[model samples]
Target: MLKVLFAGTPDVAVPSLRTLAADTGHFEVVAVLTRPDAPTGRGRKLMPSPVKQAALELGIPVIESDPSEESFVSCLKATGAEAAAVVAYGKILKEHVLDALPLGWYNLHFSLLPDWRGAAPVQRAIWAGDSVTGATVFRITKGMDCGPILAQSTVTIGAHETAGELLERLADDGSHLLAASLEAMAEGRIVPVEQPQGAFEVARKITVEDAHLRFDVPVFAVNRQARACTPNPGAWCELHADGDANGEPTTLHVLAARPIADDDRDNFATMLANRAGNGDADGTSASSLNPGELLVTKRKVWVGTVTDPLELEQVKPQGKKAMKAADWARGARLAPTAYVK
Candidate 1:
């Protein structure tokens, strides 16, 4: 059996660690390296990383600390490990640490790379409206995710998939690829493929600004933002009362949404034009409603955009529980001409 050291953190890395630990016929996981325990949850109690918990359960020695530390290198050297595998380890390894392993280190990154060659690739792919993304097992080099490929597997993105959902699928798929890459390396049947020189996209880390939703853009773009940001910083838009003396705007967290169909969108435009020209049956000036105007009825809540109006399916208001958009709109008593910022 080939002895190996495993380094990873987070739930996404758990599947890979489990596969490597369970399959001891060809590989023996000598030890696990992960981030130190950090506070989590409401009580702020220290919590072990997912990889650390998994390793402990598997009866493997676990080290939770910075891998660049000299003491860490000394401990790794004493493990008699021939190789190391990394999956979302969350830290860049120094040259000295890489030299500690006899066969160097391999990483299982969640992207087809060369493209989306940074953090938050899966989320960025969805935000960019990409139809496909995949996992890549590569030889770790000095560059970030710019390493030579060892194995790859692709998966189609769903039309309305959220970042969290896509990551769950990719993590499962990546675990298998990581296993295969390790097996190939052990059998001497693997060759690293250098990434080609060309234009590629970088998936920069997500920021708070990325979650702010703007209604002046196309419905598809807004939908993409909602899907990409759900279950994280979360997509949100500011709602103004049109004439609030205090100038306070309510922030609405958009959890889920769908772009209207072309035909339906055309019909909605016609209806809005008529309402703008003539007072609506409810004696409200729908015509004065701007592109960012919000409408609420018994069934749903709608927001106007550049192309078509987007239906707000799920939303969360400040200091309130998540509820249907219509319910929140009704409770707020939004007027027909009320426009969101």
Candidate 2:
């Protein structure tokens, strides 16, 4: 068995830590490294990371500080760990610590490297509408996610899968891959392969502006944005027309949506304008409604876009509980062709 240092943060890192810890015959986890505890939740109480909590339960020593802490590197040097493994550890390892591990450090990234190679890879892949994405175990380098690949396992992205759901699956898959790679390394059968430079695309960290829903794009694009930003920063848009009783436009966050199919592109706009009164003297002008318009009927709620209309199934209004899209539309008393903005 080989002694190895394990470093990671968040719930996503817990499985990898637990796996390496439990497989005592193959590898001994000498010490666990994680970020310091910070305030969490509405009560704002200090809380240990999921990795720290798991390490304590499993009887492992936890180092909850950075590598630059006074004498921390010296203490780590005494662990006699031959190698290290990091998963979503939230910090880059310094050169001294990297050099300390004789067998080198391994990172289990959520995306197939040389493609999405930075923070939030899985979310960015889904956001870009990539049909396939997977896990990659690579040698840790000074550059961000720019490392030699050791092992990889690919999985298809579901059509409408949200980032939260896809991340859970990838975390489990990556854990197994990391454990197996460590086993191979212990047996001296693993060889790292250099990632192709030309195939690189960065996955930049998501921001508040990235979560703002844009109605000018295709319906599928809008749907992907909602899924990519769901349960995190959250994809939202402001209402431009319909106001509350106090005459203020409400901000709405889209939680779930589906694109409506229209076979006749030529007649689609005309048909929609007819179905919903087209905001004219006779209520039938095709030019009355514009893209981003909100069309409300008794049973369904559809929002216009550049391509086809999108049916909003679920939405969360500011300062209120999440409700069905139809319910929200019914209460808005929408004009013949009210723009959602």
Candidate 3:
């Protein structure tokens, strides 16, 4: 069996660690390296990372030290591990640490090699409207996720899948890929392939500003943005009551949304306008609702976009729990002309 050290931190990394530990015939997980305990929850209690908790359960020695420290390499070498496997370890490993192992360190990244190579590949892929994405196990290099590839597996992105949902699936699927790659390396059956030279998009970490919804864009774009930010820094917009532009704007969190079909856009707009007593005789003049305009009805709440309107299925008003969009609109008692920005 190939003695290996495992490095990971988040819950997503737990599956990969478990997979390698269970495959005792080919690999031995000598120890696990993870981030130190972090303050969590309302009480701010220091808690062990998911990886650390798992290592304790598996009876593996745990190391929670900074990789950038000068002594880290020696510490790793002391574990009697010939190689290392990393998954969301959440730190930049220096050259000396990367070279400490005889077989070298391999990283399982949640994107195809040379594409979306950065901190937030899964989130970026969904935000940028990627139709397909995959996981790649690569030999760790000095560059950020720019390592040579060892194994890869692809999956289709669902139209309405949230970033959190897609990441959960990728984590599970990639666990098997990661375990197999390590096995291949142990048997000398895998060769690292250098990444192709090309312009590639970076998946930088998502910020709170990135999660702000732009109603001025097309409905499809708005839909994508909402889905991409779901369950994270969460897509949000400023709710402005009619004739209250100078008042404090309420933050509205968009939990779920769907674009109005092209064929139904005109009818929906006309119906809303008529209900608000703002439509002309033929209703054609009121068919074009301004972007960011709100059309709240008895059952649903729709927000206008550049192309068409989007139906908000769930939303969270400032200082309130998540609820159905229609219910929130009713309780808020917003004016007919009130809209979100």
Model 1, global lDDT: 0.83
Which is the better candidate, 2 or 3, if ranked by lDDT?
Answer: 3
Give the range where candidate 1 is weakest over 10 consecutive residues by summed lDDT. Answer: 279-288
Q: Order the candidates by lDDT, highest first — what do you get?
A: 3, 1, 2
The superposed Cα distance between candidate 2 and the true structure at residue 102, in angstroms, equals: 1.7
lDDT of 3: 0.89
- In terms of lDDT, model 2 sits at 0.82
- For candidate 3, list the clashing residue pairs, or say none: none
Error of 3 at 241 (Å): 3.7
Candidate 2 per-residue lDDT, tens place, 1-341, comes to: 98989999889899899888888889899999999999999899999999999999999898876887767778788888888999989887777878878888999999988889998898899989999999999989888888898899999999879888898899888899999998897798998899886766799888888998888888788889888987677888877554333356678888888776545333445556556556323543323335678766665677777876777889988887899988987886676646666
Q: Please give, for residues 88-115, the per-residue lDDT of candidate 3 as tens digits.
A: 9999988888888999999999998799
Please list the residue runs of candidate 1 whose C-alpha ends up more than 4 Å from where it truly belongs after superposition. Answer: 241-246, 261-289
User: For every model shown, what is its TM-score relative to the native structure?
Assistant: 0.90, 0.87, 0.94
